[model samples]
Target: MRFSEEVCERLDNYVYRLIDPRNGETFYVGKGRNNRVFDHAAGVLDVADDDNQTLGSKLDRIRAIKSAGLEVLHIIHRHEIPDAAVFEVEAALIDAYPGLTNLQGGHASSDRGPMNHLELIDKYSLPQFPSNPEHRLVLININKLEDRFDRRAIYNLVRYCWRISKSRAEKAEYVLAVVRGVVVGAFKPENWMSATRENFPDIPYANGSELHRIGFTGIEAPGDIWNLYVGLRGKRVSDPRLKHSQNPVRFWNC
Candidate 1:
């Protein structure tokens, strides 16, 4: 199902989607050159389940479609895009499709992902995070949080489920939940533990992924501590180094 050399050359860089023919739902979004659009269906059997849980899930979906005697559908959303602008096109499509099985978020997604009108205002108006902070802290981007204003939701999303150094995580005194660039929530970790069902029974998504990740149980920061860092209006990290990139976790002054 690969493209011919001439077609591949003409297509250049493109953004594509993989669809489940059974349900007419898009299951994956990706960007690549050559015959990359057809590669997922062709190489579905070779992907190891244990190596990457997210990718494993995608392969599983492809296998299910095949078992039903249906071929997976590939759609090129955009083609012949210049290399410089391909990332932005891919990222915008990723944001549009929330249920995509893409292994990682789009490039530079954390700092510039989807935001509402009020969120946009806060992002531009908030005070910048301290460039040289004296306190030890772990800045976590909770971009996946569904309920941003819910206190418990923010606490749960910020504290639990991360692939961070246990020793370095212990050295940090506080964890701040950053959405886009703003610090929306703050907490103090009491204990750090493996991200397993035993440690995080409340999080169903934690099952079988403990080998490479860790989480924490913690209390909300004291009023003064929260005010200093999060403030009443919230603090924003404008420094390029401090902004959330591909990795959601950032350790500061530790």
Candidate 2:
């Protein structure tokens, strides 16, 4: 079903076509806001974290199509239409593609229902932040990490530290130390070790300074260690500490 331009303006809805990459078969028909195409591309809706499995399942179907070499085509429509009209559009779209099946249990035929965020949380054992007061404050800011710390940056830091440490525990310890230092605003060589242990007591810190010592001597300036620190703190690239003049070379060399 297509949307009238008037309806499109009010509804902001669209039908996404997930076609098999190999044969251009329309494998899935679904509707969402027009701007959610990027989330579709990134498989954000497919994240199986219990909070969003319903949507995730739908997204996974699309991913399967892509994996089979299909291209996704989005037919932008409106989201503000009456439930009857929205279902009619979806039903018509599915009818146009005979092979597609309604995995959403044909719920579009019923009245639109509101979803509860807490219900999702209860159903899915989603990860929650530590209850500790100090960590709780940091949890509020965890989402900010996505903007500053892209997957590539985190991967590079993890891999580099792992290679140098020769052990996973050592690698985790090293990374967490840098993370703590960045969060607590302690960049001094003398204070870095104690600060890490104080913030993350759960992590063993027999000699917290060892990681810093190795990082200062072994890695190059603005390497994984520095990037990891910036990522954990979710600091922008333009932050003052990242400036060439204020870089952590002195701490490393110390």
Candidate 3:
């Protein structure tokens, strides 16, 4: 917590932590250069984006610590890290402390491969495939749930199913909602929260009877018509089956 100005200036790049002095618990993790730690502890608001409130949570947390009349405990965990490696180190720290208020898991250089929501929106909007044509995406094969492959049923499942891991659901950045070998819809999940009958009362079948009400995300459903590839026999799509295409896939690449 104590470093002379001369010592601080010598630090090129580092990963640091902000600990709540009262409890000795780490509440935030970040990576940056000299004096970066002080800027955060000083509560400096730079580059204020009108719409982005994610960083505000961290600032609020820091304020709460200061309100208790104890200075924030700052620790430089790693020093002299190059710009390229700092992000990865910061991400590792975040993963270690999962409940930290920091959002977006540090900028670790495209964590989920190249297929992200922004990139895919641009990909499909401009369908003249790029020179690197191997686009990867998380495909949700609704065909497996044959009886419930329609729009209405699939919607409820993704939103209400507690069985689905939070990471898996989010990784489906541009979900290719497939049914009977055709791509019927593309959905982007914004965020996930525990489902409740009281909140999502309109979910046609959830009559205060679901055994588990946990992972729900508002689906960004595609518009009326979509591009679906009907196979040679107009049967199910085999080439990109969940296993075949390595879909339901992690680390999706475009």
lDDT per residue as tens, model 2, 11-39 = 66555665555566676666665345546
Candidate 3 at residue 25, lDDT?
83
Residue pairs with backbone overlap in model 3: 181-237
TM-score of 1: 0.91
Candidate 3 at residue 212, lDDT? 40
Return the candidate ranking by TM-score, descending: 1, 3, 2
RMSD for each model, in Å, please? Answer: 2.6, 17.7, 12.3
Over the stretch 1-254, how does candidate 1's per-residue lDDT look in tens digits?
67999999999999999999989999888778887778775544334322456667788888889899899898999999999999899998988888787766777887888889988998899887787778899999885777666779898888778878999999999999998889888899999988888888898577875667888999999998888888877888987767888788999888
State in Å the error of residue 247, model 1.
1.3
How do the candidates rank by lDDT, highest first?
1, 3, 2
Regions of model 3 farther than 4 Å from truth = 1-5, 48-52, 108-254
Q: Which segments of model 1 are wrong by more than 4 Å?
A: 44-54, 144-147, 204-208
- Give a tens-digit lDDT track for model 3, residues 190-236: 76555656656676555554444344556644442123221111122
Instruction: Answer with 1 or 2, whichever has the higher TM-score.
Output: 1
